[model samples]
Target: MRRSRLGRFGSRLQSRSWPRFVPRFVPRFLRCLWPDTLFGRLVMILAIGMFAGQVLTSTIWFDTHESRTLEVPARLFASRLADTARLIALAPDDAARRALAQQLGDPKYQIAWIAAKAPGVDATSTAGFRREPIVQRVIGDLIRGVLARRLGAPPEIRLLEANVHDDSGKRGGILNLFDSPMPTGDFHVQLKLHGTGWSGWLDVRANEGQADALTEPHSLALDYLVRIYLIRFTAVCVLAFIAVRFAVQPLRQLAKAAEALGRNIHRPPLPVTGPSEVRSAAQSFNAMQQQLADSIAQRTRFLTAVSHDLRSPLTRLRLRAEMLPDPVWRERLRGDLDEMEAMVTSTLDAVQGIEITETRHEIDLDSMLEGLAQDLREAGHAVSIAGRAGRPVPGYPRNLKRCLQNLLDNAVRYGERADVQITDTGRSVRIVISDRGPGIADAALRERVFEPYVRLASKEGTGLGLTISRSIAAAHGGTLTLENRAERGLDAVLSLPRED
Candidate 1:
């Protein structure tokens, strides 16, 4: 039971047809993957190259600017602190000496100096120090160096010392005092002045101030770089797009011309424009179109001539056969002549059909199918119609009707019963014509069964029926297919593209 139901379902599926108006998205995908189109490849290349160039330029600019702006200033401040410490250690008198010690103890000094006359003189003592303001000024200068632009107020200061002894073993109270409590900022340098045996602890704040000076210049340079890059990139993109479009314009024309030629052999030549290469391609396409048109015209003329010439001979043959003495032989001869005449007419019709351009308009498919069924029924064929009524399909109504008539006629002749079904396949509309007859041979399934003068053995109809059907399908940008039903029949499917 399951097998039987499955067979029936398969039969129904085999009978289904497709629609004509399905979007060609798959072709676009193919173009992207293996970009045969000139415009596509050019745009892709331009985008990638621009991206790479921008990245390289930005990396080089950043590396060069970082070292110049940030690293050089810190080093210069450290060297200056060492030189300043040496200068202060060589001061001449005790008054000057005391002043230097006060300078060292001032909180504002970025580089501080300290001195001791004897071993026991307290490092923190302010005794006998009358020039405090001078000491404060010197300390302020050091603080300015330490903080640079960052200093909000002066910092606190501290002083420390170690005692020394002479050769007699009696110690000098305070031998030397060192500057301490370094002002902490971004950079700190400690310098120990040698000789004079008075180790001067120089705490130098090395905010060399170069970064503040360079900031505006570097920013301006970066801004200019960005603006230049943007302008260049925009210009390149626009130019590239235009150049690419111009380069590919001829190809686009060639493609359209080729398609038109295929659609209508007598299509006009493509316009010549753009560069020499583009003009050449356009010229070639035009030539090709002309050649194709000539070929088709020649073939059409030949078929017409042959068809006209054969008619007279066929008429004479019929006249001669009618004069035969035996009635049965005469009748048989007449029948044969009639069949020949029918075949000739069909052949001419099929040939002419190829030249017939599709006239697209919205056609009510359900009504068309119903009318076909009615006509077939009136002609005494057992035809059944089923399925939901669908929206109109955009196609040539006359050609579509003729194609359907052929399929229905064949179905009636072979199966002795015809069933027509319509379905909306979302992207397309499918028409399934099922005939309860012996199915087609599997060996010929993939063959071009719709070619002119080709017919299945089971189908007792004009050989051009399927060919005409397929031509009509192709004209409407659809397809016609024949398949064997899993049950006991053959199926003819006509698929028409939907607009939506």
Candidate 2:
């Protein structure tokens, strides 16, 4: 049930409108989130880290700039107002005092003044002078209390201010400040005449314009930070991609070489290159392949030479045995010599054929099996072709025919009937031959049953047939397996991969 659900889900996924993009995009995005590949995961981690760092740095910069620009300038404006108040108190006459007040009121200074109290006055009247809106508002309630007693209430309130500076210290523009309503009555103050009779009028209310000096610098910094982040991110990603590709190139080459070896064991050794570790791995693989090839070649050569050398002596022995005087002795000697000769021939053929390089071509397996069956039937053996005829496969036709013949002969000679079946399994072709012969012991099923002189009590003939058949199958990128049928008899299965 679970498998059925999965199959349905797979079908749905594959049938989506943008199916092609799903495979490439989904896996990559998932890898970016929790990457399976080394390069992809590494890049993901680096990208996340860089982005986090940029955010953190930007936050710190904005906080620092806000404090420097807004808070610091607000305090400076308050200090400047105090200084202007002192200058008004020191002026000699009303004209000189008025001149100072006018200078203080200049738009560049952003200052205003209100005179509601005078120096050395009664506390009740002085309270009105201290209620100057612009100065008291800028300083706030607490600081206003301290400054009010120190500066005293003049005739009017004096305020000094200026437009906020941009990052480059240029005025941004006029800024708006809300004014709170003052207490009842427009209280005005007059300076008392000292013994000399000099007096002047004062306006005691004053304030500086609002300015956010920190904002421009903070914004500029953030902009620069964002630009730098973009450039660096791009450059780092490119460099990371290049480095990852370079690092993985050797692995890709190794995979290709491995696939080639699987297809053809005799393929030439791979060229070792890349980093030290990759080069070492390639060198080891090449060495192992060479050693395996050399070992196979050496065994084949040894078997061929031994078989060839034994044949001549066996032939001479058979001739000598025929000359023996006693009939039974001569017959016995002849049988032994013939058996030896047969073993030698089969062994030599199996060994030499294993190493024989043959040109591959397309061959109809069903046609070949039909022909073999016809030949065997004509020779008085009951051989039949079963199952569906499969598609033509590429192989050394003569070699494959010979191998099939050996299997059929074994079945007919021992089991009395041969049944051949051909099947196409998509990736490969399978040819199964079954017979009613008594199968060999299970203990020896995987033994050297293919050895030239080895044979089961219930079977006859030299035992190299299976060996030669398997070698042929292997040469064509396939395998041969032998097993006893569950009910009765033995089965030989030849599986050959489809040619590209």
Name the regions of candidate 1 deviating beyond 4 angstroms: 1-40, 55-287, 441-448, 456-459
The local distance difference test score of each candidate is 0.62, 0.63
- What value does the lDDT take at residue 98 in candidate 1? 47
TM-score of 2: 0.51
- Residue 338 shift from truth in candidate 1, angstroms: 3.0
Evaluated at residue 423, the lDDT of candidate 1 is 86
The ten-residue window of minimal lDDT in model 2 covers 176-185
Error of 2 at 378 (Å): 2.6
Best by TM-score: 1
lDDT of 2 by residue, 1-500 (tens): 99999999889878866424234534554533465576676676667677668767765554333333333344444355556657876777656666777877643343223232445534223443444243334334323443455566432332222223443334322121111111111112222222145433333332233343223434554565567677777877787778777887788788887865654557767778777899899999999888877887888888878887887888788888888999999989988888877777776777665554456678888788889899999999998777754677887787888889888988898888999887887679888899998776584664567655577766677777888787777777788888888888888888988853
Model 1: per-residue lDDT, tens digit, 1-500? Answer: 99999999778667744322222443443433534556756876786588668867765554333333323443354345434544565776444644664565423235544444446544445453333232233333443455333323332323121112122333212111011111111334344443544543444443333423322434554565567676777777788889889777767777766654554555556778778888888888878877776777788889889889999999999999989999999999999998888888888888777664454578888888889899889989999988854678877788788888888988898888899888887678888999988777674652566766766665455778788888778876788888888888888988887851
lDDT value for model 2: 0.63
